[model samples]
Target: MSAWLPIAPCTPRDCAAHEGARRAPLAAAALLLAGCALTLLGVACVPGVRLLAPSLRDRLVRGWAYAVVRAFGVRLRVTGCQVEPGRPATGELVVANHVSWLDIPLVAAVLPARMVAKSEIRHWPVFGRFAALGGTLFIERDRLRALPGAVHALAGALAAGSRVAVFPQGSTWCGRDGGGSFRPAAFQAAVDAGAAVRPLRIAYRTPERAPAGAAAFVGDDPLAASLWRVVTAAGLTAEIRVLPPIPAGGEPDRRALALAAQSAVASDSANRPAASVHH
Candidate 1:
């Protein structure tokens, strides 16, 4: 006989929860469509204020990101010292571990910075347009020849006083192993620009104060499935710890800078409480 005997039947509560999960994705999809439409409309009007009043555009994008996160029923909690708006006294490079698709909006909601996203995202329907309008820098990670150009562009952006956000891990993990190790290639921009690398830790928890495993986008999980999980997850909270910035100037090279930032992020993630669900 197989060790796995016959499966147990679902209880009424379990069935009801499953039904809710089925509906959550539909609801989230509707909200996303509406949000994208509004965002596009706002972007269309950017030309009027692009030069005279630039910050207005950034604020609009940030507001859209906040609305999208709230619509998904995910609560965001930010801790640690925050960098003031506008260019820092020194160049700034924001580094964080990749978690779920939600990481993009979560970071945008907190900070106004151009993201360095994978090139595949550039063709992802409405989101691609939105990201492009928001000044995202797309890179083909698989192409070795493209690294120098991307790095140079990133360095230029940082030197121009733009806060650039990058996920050095190159891929998303299930928030296990503290998001694996950070890749040092992206850190080259910081070294070239002499920017300060600020590490941010992203953590997720359920309403019951447990790890929100359902919210993790790992393995072969589809985008729709992850969205359903997030929407149906009760009181899912995303905790963002904005750890102190490490000066790139002190590092001997890009690899050293990358290691230092990775250490800072891992240490912070280790010290924080496992579950950070706010009441």
Candidate 2:
């Protein structure tokens, strides 16, 4: 497999563990309904994204992003390095470990940026419209030849002073044991554009801070199933830890920058070995 399609050992059976208190069925249903309503509102908001001034755009995205998670009953607690909410982060690359579908909105809650997403997502139901309206950069991961153009497009966006977000692990990992390796390919865009990289570490935990895997959206885990687990898990808190941004000149190259960002992200956690990917 190409590096863009890095394999993860995480599967729905092994990694998506149920943790934390669960909501009553009726309550869970209510939360799901709320999430759906917010999602519709978000889709409506996306068309205005490119029209609004940068500050208003960021504010709108950030607020709606937080509302999406909150409506689903996930309490978000952000910690560590903070950026001003209204200010635009020019030419910034926001990087985070992939854990669940929820990771997308979680990052947006921090900083609104052009998302580098799988091309398939651009065809997903209402989400496709949302992503397209918000100006997502879709990459054809299965087509290895398409990678260069994707990188060039990402570099171009950054060069235009637009903030961009990417999940460089290329696959989702359960945040326990350890998240999978960060593929260095996306970092090249950062290097080419001379953009700063903001390393964000994300974890879903209980209100008591125990690692919760109910949010893991790994191999073959249906989105509907994951959404059910998330909204039904009562007191689920998402830990959004923002590490210091790595300056554009901090590393000599993208490979080194990727490694440096990975080290910074994993430094606080005792990264135990995750299950290996079988060829």
Candidate 3:
């Protein structure tokens, strides 16, 4: 386990004062459209680019994510030990707490790993197409029969030296209660592939550096409403803390691996100052 270092805490007063301030909707819309265009263009070019340079497609996907983060005006700050991009020699699994839809771009902006998302996301208008082009692995959460196959596919990807990112909590949380308990099934992929599990903590803050509840997408929150809130917020920042990787060899089974990873994340979350607000 790594020591938890306290970053400067954002004040509630600062957050309250900035609540009334809003960015222009027209500007946000324009930026959103521009981002979508760039992403779609990148996706369209991937097939051709992949033929010439295999890695360039992944790089383009990452660039698209970076553009989305910037267009939304969200500041990203990463903490803790940094891990290099691409697959590691022993394989790697990134497990993180989920708070909002912003987590996707925020993670992609830094880490170059194929994300494991819910199957329904593949049908979500334009975003679905972008996700598929980015090489996301979709898991059918509602069908229990589909889980074993999904796990097997994930394991195969890892064994082939691909870094895979998963939100073991299965659903988004309000950044409260440590973002819910992590489900153990995903850990099996790590075990089967002999991969190390990396636990990451994601926190959102306002421009004033205060915890940002407005950025969280929880409950039955409409996607448009959440997007409007983030774009209109005075300022939003995503703070990502990457903890030490838990080696798979020592874990006796998937259950043990899952518990260890969850414990590490929970402990890190509890010790760190509550710097992000949730919806």
Candidate 4:
């Protein structure tokens, strides 16, 4: 899998830290149960949600996403929402730094888009059903042969004015410190459709705002263990900073476009916040 799938050097032992505040076992279990219930509810509502108007559906999805994150007892802080005075809300590619499983709902809360997930997620229990219901595009990242088809699908969606979210890093990293680069192949879709690239940076922190490494879902970490640690981490905050959108049409090629996006996401001084939300 390392041949095609991007690999990160971070392991649970080296990357995860137990520095965050802890919650009682009972509280953690309660929070996890609440989160699970909310997810199931979201899944059940998908068919009804699909019948609603686009604008209304977007709002409902965002609200549901917010609730999911909140139910897990994670405080969300958002900065730099990508909005213009009269820009069309669709036809843009939403890209972000991947940190944990929490990132899916977190981004959806901000900008509800057709998520680009791995094929493995399609076989998971509740999340898989929800993902399929919500129109997630599953990519076989380990297989090089599937690359073109994925890109073509992404381009088709963008051409039809759909906002699609993808993590070009291919796999999850420990944190943003030293992870995989944004692969250029995905950028080709944006270039083909003349879509803009919207980049966002997501980070996990303690109540004191220190880096919450315990939240990292790095190498050799089981999903249940990561999920448990996330629920039990008291006052664990996810700070999402949205960077400026790049016009992919302006770039010479996908490589340059990818580099520009990677640079924007990695930079700390990208700019001031257009708006801030503490949810």
Name every residue pair that clashes in candidate 3: 211-277, 212-277
Put down candidate 4 lDDT per residue, 1-279, tens digits, no spaces.
Answer: 532278878888888766767999999999999998998899999989999988889889989999999999888888876453222554899888778888999988887889998899999987798799898988888888998898999999998898999988877787748468988888999998889999888888887767788678888799888888889999998888878889757689999998899988888664344455545
Write down the lDDT of every candidate, Cα atoms only: 0.71, 0.85, 0.72, 0.83
Instruction: Quote each prediction's TM-score.
Output: 0.80, 0.93, 0.82, 0.93
TM-score result, candidate 1: 0.80
Each prediction's number of clashing residue pairs: 0, 0, 2, 0
Candidate 1 vs candidate 3: which has greater TM-score?
3
Residue-level lDDT of model 1, residues 91-162, one tens digit each, is 689999777888888887777688998788899886687678667889877777788888998999899888
Worst-scoring 10-residue span by lDDT in model 2: 270-279
Residues 1-279, model 3: lDDT tens digits: 001111212222222223635778787677567755665676677556556543565666566777777777676777766556544775689998877888887777666788998788899877688678667899887777787888898999888888889888776665635656678888998898888899888878766666677667765667776777777775677877777889878689988988888888778453464443221
- Looking at candidate 2, what is the lDDT of residue 8? 91
Model 1 regions more than 4 Å off = 1-52, 268-270, 273-279
Question: In model 1, how large is the Cα lDDT of residue 203?
Answer: 73
Model 4, residue 123: C-alpha shift (Å)? 2.2
Estimate the lDDT of model 1: 0.71
TM-score-best of 2 and 3: 2
